[model samples]
Structure formats: structure tokens, C-alpha cells
Target: MNWETLIDEESLALLLPAEYSHFALPIKESLAVFLSRLPQSVQDRLVEEQLALPVDATLSERLGRLAHSCPVLQKLGQILARDQRIAQELRSELAKLESMPSTVPLHSIESILMQELGPLESKSIELLPPAIAEASVAVIIPFREKNKPQQPEGVFKILKPGIVQRLQLELDILTEVGSHLDSRLHDLGIPPLDYQDTFNQVRDKLRCELRLDEEQLHLARAARFFADQIDIAIPELFEHCTPRVTAMERLFGEKVTDHNFTLTTEKQNLAELVARAMIVQPILCKDEQALFHCDPHAGNLFSTNDGRLGILDWSLAGFLGAREREALVQVMLAAICLRPEKIATTLLSLDIRGQCDQALLKECVAIWLRRMREGHMPGLSWLTGLLDEAVKTARLSLSSDLLMFRKSLLTLLGVLSEIGANGFDLDQIVMCEFLRITVMEWPGRWLSSPNSRSFATRLSNLDIAETVLSSPLIAGRYWQAMWQDSIERYAVCANSR
Candidate 1:
């Protein structure tokens, strides 16, 4: 694909709003400079392909088509599809990329399997005709083991042929564009953002998705973490696996967004299950590091027949260290208690450079609190909004892990809204999960002094201690706020009457 030609002046102009037209020429020039640096053969190939490309009428269509051709852009589209902030038309167009049609032929997939896992016949594996599913970077082929009839059918997730080269090329383009943008932010009339740093972070994450070995490791670790949960199902890894291909137990169910439920109760239950699996459990996990599914799009999540939430695609994940986890918990606690000052303090502490304006940070926290009190659900949106405001208002720097987690949560919230779970009180859910963990661990925490415990155990105990000491005060404040709200409601009712 000729990205430079495809992302020509017209396409770039279409991407930017009319008000931002001034920014387009610089971007185009930057892209041109980057493309010129490509090898002669690569440049020639791109030039050859330029004439063969089809044209789309609208911007959305063009973008969707481009995403289909470029895996990196397809990933960006998938993320944007779940974002409500984007234009509905664009979101709808990008959403189609989630269930991209299988462009890779069956023979190509079969060849990858043979190359990676040797002959299917030797392994007693029979590859099913046609692929069962296809995504941005890989195609999933269902296969059955002739020798293991008792075992469930498995699917081989094979990377698309030449994806590595294509993806790396696109990533390099993005990096070049980001660097240019970073240097020209002032001329573009946009606020200064670490565009280079941001793209580097994104590049690292996308690169991780290329490695199936890391995904397998994540899957194994997640399986251990959720070992006791009956409601969650992690696919079991099969022996025949490679970096380009992974064999795992095939799960059967509809996408959570697509599932049809006869009852709202069922939908609500499924929503809570999604919440627990994606948000609550990961946040309150006892492990030293909490592993979160970075991509929780509808395509990656399934509503299994056995009433279990099947979380698939472990390729991209985020890990929160103990300190980060505790900080998150503290922020949640403060939010639930409606303590804006505490929230500000917690956020400022995270700014290792200590450059944030405390007053401005407090104001931002207060605004978030006001929204929550006005019935905005304190879920990912609320938390992310607070962080974003902090960044804009106080110039606070947040960790990349939290930013990645925010993206995951944003995607999860989009899924929840699709399944009618947006109404679920996430603030209440967080409080409940925290209390459950505190109560469950109280005995051990009470028996052992903080001094006797290991560093990780001490941190765990400290979390419990804070929760134990704050619950009553938080409860009292919560009731007081509820009472005040109820009284106001009564007054409004009386006045209407």
C-alpha cells in the first residue's frame, strides 16, 4: 500500500477540520519527507500501487478502507470506534473494522500453521475449511484434533502474512508524523502535548501485540489470577503454539454487544460480570502486579453459553504495580467519599516531578466531584475526565500505565453502554469490591502485625487498614449527602405540587 499517496493532501485535508486547515500542509510535507527516506525498491512499489488503489467517496469511507489496508490504522480505528467523543458517522464507519472480512486466503493460513507447527497431519490436527474469524493483525482458523476427541475444538490464531513488515512500516510513519507534530505544535495552534512521547508509548504497545509468546505468558498469569472465579473463562493453551500462531480452546458464544437477552435482568447481570471481569477484579487483585486486558472491545469479549464471561485476545495488556494499584484505590476511595481535597493530594503525589498547581488540581477534582454528585457515574469517564482536566489545568504528568488503563476503561465503558450496562453505578461497584476485599482479608491482616509482613504484604495490609479506618467516615458522609439530596428532591416535589 502507498501510504504516502493514500494519505495525500486531499486525504489529510479531509481528516482535519476546516479550522485546522493551516496544520495540514506541514503534516503533508512531513509525511512526504518520511516517505522519501524509504528504500528505492519500497518507494517504487508504493508508486506502482498508487494507480491500482480504489477511491472512496466520503472521508469515513476512505478512512475505513485505509484502516483495512493498514493494520496499525485499523487498531487506531478500533480504539476510536469505541470512543463516544468521535463523530457518530466516523465511529460507525470505523466500527466495521472490528469484524474485518478475512482477506487472507485459507491456503495462506494453512501454510502458516504448517510452517509454525509443522504438518497438521503429524499433530493429528485437521484444519477446518474457511476461517472462523479475522481481526486487524490475525486470522483465526478452527481445527479439531483427531486423537483428542474428548477435548473441545481449538482455534489457531495466525498472524497475517507480511503483517510484520506492513505494521512496522505504518508504525514508523506514525512515529515520523508524531515527531513532526511535536516540533510544530505552536504553528498548528494546538496546546503542547508530548506527541513524540505519546507515539513512542503507542508504538511500544502495538509492538507488544506482535508477540504471541508474551500474550501466552499473560494468559497463563491471568488464568492463575482468576483460577477460582467460576463466572470467568480463560481459554486453555494448547501444546501446538508459536510466536506467529497460538492454539487455544475455542469458546462458543455471541459478542457481549450482540447477545440477545429476553430479560433486562440478564443484561444487567452480564453487565456486572463484564464490570467485575474487566474493572473491579483487576483493580482489587491481591497479586503484586494486576494484569488488565488492554483491549476490551466487543470483538475480543464473548458471552459464553455456560454463563461465563469469556475474555479473549491477551496480546495487549497493562500491568499495575503495587504502588500504582494502591494509589488507584486511594483515588477511588476519595472519589466515593466526595473528598476532592484528598483526590487532589493523591493525584499530586503521583506527579513525581511535583510541578502541578495544587489549587488548580483541587479545582479540577472539585469539578469532577460536582459531576458525580449531579448523577454522572464515576466510572472510567469520570476518572479519565479528572485526569485530563488535571493535565490541562495543572500541567500534571500521569504515568503511561494509567493512561493505558484509562484507554482500556474507556473501551470497556463503551462496551458496557452497548450492552445497557452504562446505568450501573460503578462508584458503588468499586466501593463494594473494595469492602469485599477488605472484609475477606481482615482476619489475616488482624492476626499479623504490619512489621512482620513482607513488603508486598505490608502494602496489602496498609490498603486494608486505610479501608477499614475510612469506611465508617465515608459511610457517614455518603448518608449525609444522600439525605441532603433527598431533602432537595422533596422540596422540589413540594414546590411542584
Candidate 2:
């Protein structure tokens, strides 16, 4: 249906805030640096987009629209199967089920679903089931819809237990979430990606508490969505994701995140290694920017016998950009260095609230920054205090990614603190290592050193040069024209209006 073209026009109104676009000081040169790498086709597409979009939009607004309007995400697995290996393995497993007795239960479950959800919105149970309940196994069952019997996803899967019932309930809710978000965005005339964090949280809670296989399966898919793809489809797919019930079977591996068992000096290195790996992860996995591994938690990450890190649980992920990732590292680095103002600035830059008590925010920033700076995980005083304040004051909803970022950070820090990371300095050699890597690919100019007066001076010069160059060619023509002075202009324009 050439959905990309269909959506591009309407998406601008939501993405470009009216207040931001009308600013005379355009950020073109900065944008040009980014645009140079794009293909001619994409550039042409973007040019049309930029022309239609308001000139004074914020970077976030512009980037947000671009993210959701892109088409590739909508058509995942359509071109060639990116995960052919995983798909093939799944198919083989299903085949093996046909020859085993375990196939009976899955067949029963599929039968249970077909009668419930209808033929559409369901994966085909055409494949057989698993023979044994391996530690972590995912099962797909088919069914009919309670309302409409004819949808594509009536079929579903499980990652834990309580599959069939929970998903039906949750799917409807997510659909509503998507619908309401869709309506609000449509009103703004912007084609935007709906936030999936809450929806995925519900999905994760359902999986972890219920221990359903399909829930975990969906989580894995969510992870895959963030980890490997940057298409708009991730949100849409997640919006319509049907879990019904999922069980995430425990996979066997050397447990990661194990902080306590008074380790021998020999094993201390392994513990340190796992701990170090946690920090290095965001740095090492730049190539997979396409995916968002939202949960790099100890429980979710494991080390194999061969020392390869195994990351599981991908149920919630968004297509995060490089700038966001870089900002994260920088914020942490600043925290370690006890740079309170820098940390406050970075946090606010992440869109905490456009205008709040800057001093208060700095105080809060300093508190947390101090903890991370000292490599200590502070108590709930640092976290719940703000969260409690925001909730009490108003329903302050920040980016859910920011929420996840906080959760992961807290979890990591809390673990390190509990385990006695005596010399685990946040501003240690690792900071320099990450700093070099970050500088190597810092996406935005915002990350440069604060004390670099020379760079600042050059930027000031460039701004002046660009402003002079961009002087309107419309020059004295429009400048000299009186407002509605021409009789023909007034009469003709009035008539058209």
C-alpha cells in the first residue's frame, strides 16, 4: 500500500512543534553533516519531508517523526528472513514434536485457542510441539478472536504459564493503548511511534509472574525488535502484540549477576569480569544499534562455558539512536567525575521537564551523580524521592526509555554496592576507555568538552558565517513589499482563501 508515502505528509504536524520551527536561526549545517551519509533516495525523501516539516522544530521532534515514519520496521522478515537460523531451528523443533508425546499438549492448547480467538491474528499451529520442557522454551498456540474471528494474530504463544487468558485481556489493552496514542498523534497530524515501554512492562510482568512461555517469547521478539531493527514496525508490532499467556523457561547457564557467595580470589576475577562486561556492553555493541537490548540485567545476561555472554529477555525495546546511547555514557562519566552541573544539564537535555527548578534538579542530579561518582548505589532516597515527588506534584511522564535506563543503572549499581566493589571506581580507567570510544562516534556536538573555548569560538564563527550565507535571496524584494498593498494580490488571494 506504499504506506511510507501515505504517512509522511500527515506526520509533520505532530513532529515539528509550531513554536520551534519558526525560529530564524536554522540548524542546517549540523543537519547537513548527518545528511551526507544518507543515500540519494533517502535524501530526496528527507528533503521533501524537511520542506513539509516546520522549520523551527526541536531535534527530538524531528528525529521522533523520522523514526516512526520510516517503512522498513513495518515490514520485518518481509524481504529475507534476518533470523533464518532461529526460524529454521524453531521449525526443526516443531517437527521433532510430531514424533514425540509432548506434541499432544501443544495440540490441545492449539485446539483450545482455535475455538477461542478465531482463525486470524493467530500463528499457525501447523507445526508440531516441543518434546521436553527445556529450561527456557517458547510455545506458539493457535486460536480465534473473541470479538472478530477473522484476524491474522488469533494465534499466540507463551513464555510462562497462564497463557490463553492473560494475553486476550492484555492484547485488547495494548490495542487500546495503541489506538489512543494513535488518535492523539493523528490529532497532532504527526505519524509517531507509540511508546512501548509500559506495554512491554505489562508483558514482562505477565511473563515473570505467570511464567508463561509466550510472554517470554514476545519479550524475546521485543528484544529482537530493539536489538536488530530500527523500523517503525517494532512499535506497531508491539502495539498489536498478542501474548495470551507466555512462559519464559529458565535456560541453563553460569548465572550472571551473582553478587554474594564470598568468592575465592580465583573466582573474584570472574565476578569482576562479569561486572566489567556489564559496563562495557553498551560500548561493545554499537554494531547492533539496530536492536535495543532493554534488559541487560544480571538475571537476563549470562556467561557461557566458552565465556561468550548470552543476553536474553528482549520483550521491551525501542529503536534507540546513537545520540541517546552516547548521552547515556557521558552522563555516567559526568556522574563519576562528580560533575553535578554537567549531569543536571544532561538529564534535562533528556527532556525531564522543559522548565523546572534548575537548582533543585541540580541538587537531585548531584546526589545521584555523587553515588555513581563514588561507585556506590544510593538508597531509594535518590530514586523514589524524585519519582515520589513527580507523582505527587503531577503525573510527570518522561520517556520510558529513561525509566528503563534508570532501572538498569540502579540494578547494576545496587549489585555492585552489595558485593563490595571496593576499588570499582566509576571514574577509573574504564571511563577513559569509554570516553575515547564515545568521542570516536559522538553523534551530537553537545558532548564536547565544556572548557574547550577554542571549539566554542569556532562554532560561534561558523554560526555567524552560516547566518551571513543564508541571507534570504528574497532579500529586498519581500522586504520592500507592503503587507497586502497590491490590489490584485489582495483581491486574488482573498478570493482563493
Clashes of each: 0, 67
Model 2: per-residue lDDT, tens digit, 1-497? 13233233333333333544321122232123324434567667865775686877544344434432222211111111112222332222222221112223665665544554455345332322342321122344333334533433322444323333534443434444444444555344432433233444434433342333334554555544345422112111222244444322223344444433464552444445544444444433444342344444343455444444455445444343455554554454343333456655655665544544566666566445434333454322344444434322333344555555444544555444433445554435344554565464434445645332122112223333334554553243323332323554689989999
Could you tell me which 10 consecutive residues in candidate 2 have the lowest summed lDDT?
Answer: 73-82
Clashes of 1: 0
lDDT, residue 171, model 1 = 75
Q: Which stretches of candidate 1 lie over 4 Å from their true place?
A: 1-56, 332-345, 352-381, 448-497
Top-lDDT structure, candidate number: 1
Each model's Cα RMSD: 6.4, 23.2
lDDT of 1 at 13: 63
C-alpha TM-score for every candidate: 0.80, 0.38
